[model samples]
Target: MKGIRFWAFWPVAYQPSSLQASQPPSLFGLIGRRMTKGQRRKLNRIYFMKYCSNCGQPVIHRTPPGDDRPRFCCESCGMVHYLNPKLVVGCIPEMEDRILLCRRAIEPGYGKWTLPAGYLENGESVAAGAKRETLEEARAKVEILTPYALYNICHVNQIYLMFRARLKDKRFGAGAESLEVKLFGENDIPWEEIAFRVIHATLLKYYDDRRLGRFSFHMENISPPNPNPPKTDN
Candidate 1:
């Protein structure tokens, strides 16, 4: 456990193999309770694509004429329904030496700490989405510094992209989607309350690069059965 240490971060998200001591937080592990709306939504990709998008028709699960993967094919219309991973965009907003974090207003990790990130809405660039999320959750403007981390949570079909940003001012408060928002220095980060592994991984990388006086982009697959999908809009 002593050897497994990471600089704590709020999630935009985590990956598994990087740690020897910790596993991703699981909503199911908390208790053998029913899945929350947030948890259930993560699996919506599997169950929700019941109709064809191109034409309003019930879809059938089958491997279409030539495709190797099973798709939701419309019997009435020739359209196939394909489910893809959801993209979440956020940023590591920094003020002086502190970083901003939001207490989730929604579940699977309700009340947990996370970076200011959410699903990228249609017609928005990655950079725009990241900056918008920061403002929406933390109520703060920022100067996006650079792209920082990208995490793929295959099990839950989510990809989180996080950026490095400079907070425009210190006058931020919790947004409507957040319970509370706060800033913390590196050592003061709330590791146990962290919302996702991807966020944690991104934070560790941020501090490492800061110490080296150089920030570099990172990409990693946040391994399987990712149970801590945010209940928020993402």
Candidate 2:
């Protein structure tokens, strides 16, 4: 019985020779896989030598080797490109039975509908940033009721925090960043035309959760659609 079981599970447990083969090569992988230790060190000395990404100045000796990964120092601007994560704040503001939406006047998705969202300013709280963005884009004052989502967008290196908010006053108009602003009920929302994958996904989740008479938050990276990319330069 043990032999029979082992035979039966062998295919499942054992990796095939083809599957065990090395990873498909990339530029970095090929360099890493083929290079000798000395060659790798030479490559590292050439490519990974400390250089300020901000000012393009060499920063070879400043950081201690024990640090493993150290940020470059820029003497000219006193800047460091530490590659910190950016904070993005968004809000789903509701009034009565309708939700607020804005048509962007900025690049990346001009004239497309979206939830009020933007990068968090320095020293601003996530909720404060969300409320501020709502006011800035839609000219509407919002009271944050609860968090709606916390997403990590790795491609852009941003951490997004979304909130469910209540509009203090329904009176709103388009702000400088927005071409138009309006409230839409579930049926009236332009499902097909909504901009920003995160916004669309949040709305769908919102409606789905609403049907169950409950509110739940979601967190995921929703890549931006390229069909109608922002056309600020044009």
Candidate 3:
């Protein structure tokens, strides 16, 4: 479960060329000017099986290596495949001075708490994704308050957007993805049992922002720890 979640939600990091020049090159780069055509082809084949980041289609084959660049051709839509970040959206919904949270019933963080969140669906706006996740996980309607936190999980390669929201009514229950649904004041939140670093960070930010009566948005990159972090899903 942890492995699956790590691959699904974590962000992948690429060292910038400028940064690389300042430090020792990786073993692969040290041996060559660039990835060899054969190496790029192999990488492309692996990438295609992971699906087209653009159209969600399984890329059928590697494109002919061209100009020493990696390329893949999608079979479903004939689109070129290029690695890109996937967008995820979530919301922290507040009602009566408490924040809504869900206990995930699925792995990576089974039994751990999280804000309602999931990947953005095709043709959906970020806000729509947030709303949909809220409904899907908590069975509640909420009004978006403001942008909250934006984070890049670079270990697996995902961009997360969290929105501050106000519950339309104090009416919600556990939905498909959740084992339980409840609200918690800051002091009562299960800090050590939270699902992910991003969620923990977001909750911290929310508390600070609420106390100051000031709302501001920020972004950060979160790296997963080595040796496989503990699972939080129920």
Candidate 4:
């Protein structure tokens, strides 16, 4: 079950660029380059499957007769396992001149602030998943106004769909996944403590739209963060 959760919710099947000769460049590996040293090591440590889930037999990592790329293939049951990217759905919950954020209780960003978001469940609509995540993470109810942004995070092999939402009421508290939930005005936002780059990008665009007195849907492709960012003389 833990393996299944990791496979579904976290990044996987990441092969570094050095190994891209035989196969295509791994978009998942790009995430490792953007992470801190410790975080990069953690992502690098997750290995591919050794056994097949279908028949509980050893699986071989090789390209089958027709497939272009390699996959986990089961000889005993003839099952082929494929790795796919995940969709992360969330909302920017807005009230009176403020937006809601939650302090994470889970790793990868434990104790840091983030918007309510999680993996989109199978068979669920993106808008419904965003609302459900808001309720689950911040204990807040919101009406999704419209999709504010769509991010293609190639590094993590994930798609982030963020919606503009209006808080139904002021009543909200921390949920099981959050240590605390609170509202923040533009000036009060903790820029350095944002949990993920994709979320940070969405927030930046949101505030930009606000300043222009209009909200527009946006789509962006994210690249790996620069490790050696230019130092500014302060």
Worst 10 residues of 2 by lDDT: 5-14
How would you order the candidates by TM-score, starting with the best?
4, 1, 3, 2
Question: Of models 2 and 3, which has the larger lDDT?
Answer: 3
List pairs with backbone clashes in candidate 1: 10-115, 11-199, 13-198, 13-199, 14-197, 14-198, 107-231
Which is the leading candidate under TM-score? 4
For model 2 the TM-score comes to: 0.68
Candidate 4, 1-234: lDDT as tens digits:
322222222323333422224443453444435544445444444335667899988766567777787676788899989878889999999997999999999998999999999999998999999999999999999999999999998776789999999999998999999999999999999999999988899899999999999999999999988969999999
lDDT of 2 by residue, 1-234 (tens): 322211111121121221212322332242424554444443344234345667766543233334444444455676644547788898999998899999989888888999999999988998999999999999999999999888877655678888999999968999999999999999999888787777888898888988999998787876644647677875
True-vs-predicted CA distance for residue 61, candidate 4, Å? 1.8
Candidate 3 lDDT at 186 equals 87
The best candidate by lDDT is 4
- Per-residue CA lDDT of model 3 for 1-60, tens digit only, reads 222211111112221221223233343352323454544543333333446677876554
The lDDT of each candidate is 0.77, 0.73, 0.77, 0.83
Cα misplacement distance, residue 75 of candidate 2 (Å): 8.6
Query: Once superposed on the true structure, which residue ranges of model 4 sit more than 4 Å away at CA?
Result: 1-21, 24-47, 232-234
